[model samples]
Target chain A: MKTEKTLVTITEEMVLNYEVIFGKQNKLPPTFPMIFYRYINVPWDYKTAPIHRKQTCVCHSELSIGESYHCVVTLDQVKQKGKYMFYTQSLVGYNLEGSECFRCVSELVVH
Target chain B: MCVRISRTLTITEEKIKQYAFLSGDFNQIHLDQKEAERYKFKEPIAHGMLTMGLTLEIASSFTEKGMRISTYEMQFIKPIFQNDLIYIVAKKKKQDYGSIYLEITGRKQNELVVRGELALERLSSIHFNNATKESGM
Candidate 1:
């Protein structure tokens, strides 16, 4: 396989694709009647070990029912892509309510 | 306070399939038991992300009125096999009107197989008002 990089946007189709993967869309209480967004970039045909590097930024539209929140997550490989494959995911807590967004970011390398 | 709950779940092949569909993670280890056994795990295991997603479901059940998860972190500990009766648990260890800390765990036959913690900010109604005032949401 050749090395490839794909940037996938969170759209209705992508959400449907994820729903297909999980089987039951209702099992997860998605903030429906609203839109959920994410950006996924994957590097294929990795030269080193088959390690996947991902970054997820999640945001939801305002809903009439409950409170709305925005959160961001950044995950990086801890190891130098050799010996061991280590990955660490950092979460940023943001309420996105009242212009107040909680934010935090962490990095990890797997060997 | 920690938001927590527990339930015994039948990890059926169909359930796994659904999870695979939702995550876009159709790895063979989760779909093929025979191929899974060939690997070091010796049995088909669920996707780590899927397991985490399930754990999130369990935690969401305990959310108090008007509260939503703002952030969380999970680490994959062990593989959950198909048809295994696994116990899933989540607890709220700390909380406030603004933020909450949650601890979640998963077990098979009473043995610890997975564990993680989450930090969720309480989604307040005040923000939606501002979003509406600013963006007409």
Candidate 2:
């Protein structure tokens, strides 16, 4: 008789890939998934079933994935400069370790 | 030496949707109002990266010709919702060697939303000039 065990290691790489595929297609904001995964302990590659299922919006109670839901990547830079800058400020600060996970995900996804 | 600056921003549904497309995050808490309410959020919230990235941008604006951000650490204290008017406050905290340190905070009215620290590296002005020249900016 042979015994086999399964070991699961979830990395930023896996999350990045998941976002690249299913994430890009939906109208979900970036922060939602980041926070969602932060608290959930399930492997992104769990073989049981699709990790994400289509769900209705709680606000309007709509389940449609319409063209309006699609985001325009080209507009991101504009959005950042215009709307984002309006609310934030620029400064200099000491280095810290809180953003390590963010850096890993950024390097894996953006670069 | 804390040098601080502040600005105001209004989170919009369009911006949230745009971030969703760029980052591939469609969590209902940000898209569906009901979902957000169910999750105990006042409304659909802005992405944390959106706030963080904007903070970095603010830092970059204060940098000299060749200076660049080298590292940062942030903690989210509150959720930022669409249509909420928020303020971003950045402060220059310290300077040592060739690095400049900063502290950033985001506030909605009187509520604290996000806060963090960052470090910027000072590069040779020549490098900055050369890069700008090469890019033709």
Candidate 3:
């Protein structure tokens, strides 16, 4: 399943809070986009949220404060093995120009 | 890969809760002991993303203008329980054409808990790909 596009904006407050929590690193943390994961995760029907087992994030270009991005989340695969269910999902963000700015692939597990 | 640095920190409940609030990951498994038991974990476990964020802290020390990461990948090999002293090591793997690669590993004492790698470049330019400054990157 794929989610409808969601617009995410990087605000000054967000950048400030992030820098305060993580560090004053001039570059945006790659995992910063994971903050919006919950928006697209609304489509899942699980009674409890799945465990985030692993993650892979890639940044294709620089993202600045005040920039807005369009994100789409896709449930890439699901497998059931006896008492366990494994889910793979990808959340991709694109700049207004439609260039892929960043992407995150998450592996989740539910029992 | 030969050059390396290491740091350690004890994961605290306060830190975990702080991250959950910031990230909007209100998973019970990360907050309640009972919920963690359901997953066969002892006590509550730190969110993988929280550790992932902390992992990048070590990587940031290697940066001058900060990091424009090409990739930040991590695997939660084992549950990181609160109070576990996490030892993190980062190695400079290689660099070429403005991009640098680093390998990182996290251990809870003697056992490996997380392993990852980062590909980074200086964050000085918004146009990341250009052969020259005047090419309109």
Candidate 4:
């Protein structure tokens, strides 16, 4: 079977669901969703927000917050099989006050 | 393909929950040990991003000061269970025009868990300049 990729945006409702799942310990950090377009030609549809200075966290430094601006990107991934499959192809955060380049982190999960 | 550094870490259920708290990824396969077993995993596995973050941390340590990662790509080969002692190894693969390329691998004992690449560039040359220019610095 051919794999399919789709971009998903975490809406407010999804965040609320996460809160429901996490219950009392529901301190979910905001993250910008992005895709590594390897061999696809798809137009960027997600609206880009105005860059504003704010404190943000990235990857392993999740506890030590730093200054940054939010950038949202749409992600496309191969359709996963089974109930427990999730692939976080990349995780990135850009420094608002320091640099235009963003820090990228990547990983995958299959069940 | 030289210059390699490795760091060891133990993945715990609490740490996995912490990652889920940060990333908003509360997948039961990663949070519930019983559910994970039903799904065929021995136990709740750690979030892939958590492992990726550690890999990036190791990669960042080898680069020059002021260098920032621009691109990171990885592939997950196996599930990482709780308390698994993971060894993250990063090797400098190539460099050109201030861009350093690195190969990263995560292994549990002799078993490969994840593999990927990273691209690093000087912060001052790339986004830093633009940020400064925008700030009229």
- Report i-RMS for every model: 6.1, 15.9, 1.8, 12.9
Per-residue lDDT over B18-123 for candidate 4, one digit per residue giving the tens place of the 0 to 100 score: 7676565556878887878776778887766666654555754534365655556666678789889989888888988767877888888899887877766664
Q: Once model 2 is optimally superposed onto the true structure by TM-score, how far is the C-alpha of residue B66 displaced, in angstroms?
A: 2.0
After TM-score superposition, what is the CA distance of residue B22 in candidate 1 from its true location, in Å? 3.3
Q: In candidate 2, which residue ranges exceed 4 Å CA deviation?
A: A1-102, A105-111, B124-137
User: Across residues B1-137, which tens digit of lDDT does each residue of candidate 3 receive?
Assistant: 36798989777888788878878888988899998898788889998988898778777665655657778999889999988899999888888777788889999868999999898876554354633444754
Q: What is the lDDT of residue B29 in candidate 3?
A: 83
Please tell me which predicted candidate would have the highest lDDT against the true structure: 3
| Candidate-wise lDDT, in order | 0.49, 0.46, 0.82, 0.52
Q: Which stretches of candidate 4 lie over 4 Å from their true place?
A: A1-111, B62-64, B127-137
Across residues A8-90, which tens digit of lDDT does each residue of candidate 4 receive? 33356444543343332112222223222222233432121111111122332221123333333334343455643433232
Q: Can you give the lDDT of residue A104 in candidate 2?
A: 14
* Root-mean-square deviation (CA) per prediction: 7.3, 16.8, 2.9, 11.2
lDDT at B34, model 3: 91
Which docking class does model 2 fall in? Answer: incorrect
Question: Fnat for model 1?
Answer: 0.06
The CA lDDT at A53 in model 4 is 12
Candidate 1 positional error at B95, Å: 1.5
- B18, model 3: CA deviation in Å? 1.4
Q: In TM-score terms, which candidate is top?
A: 3
What TM-scores do the predictions have? 0.61, 0.52, 0.90, 0.59
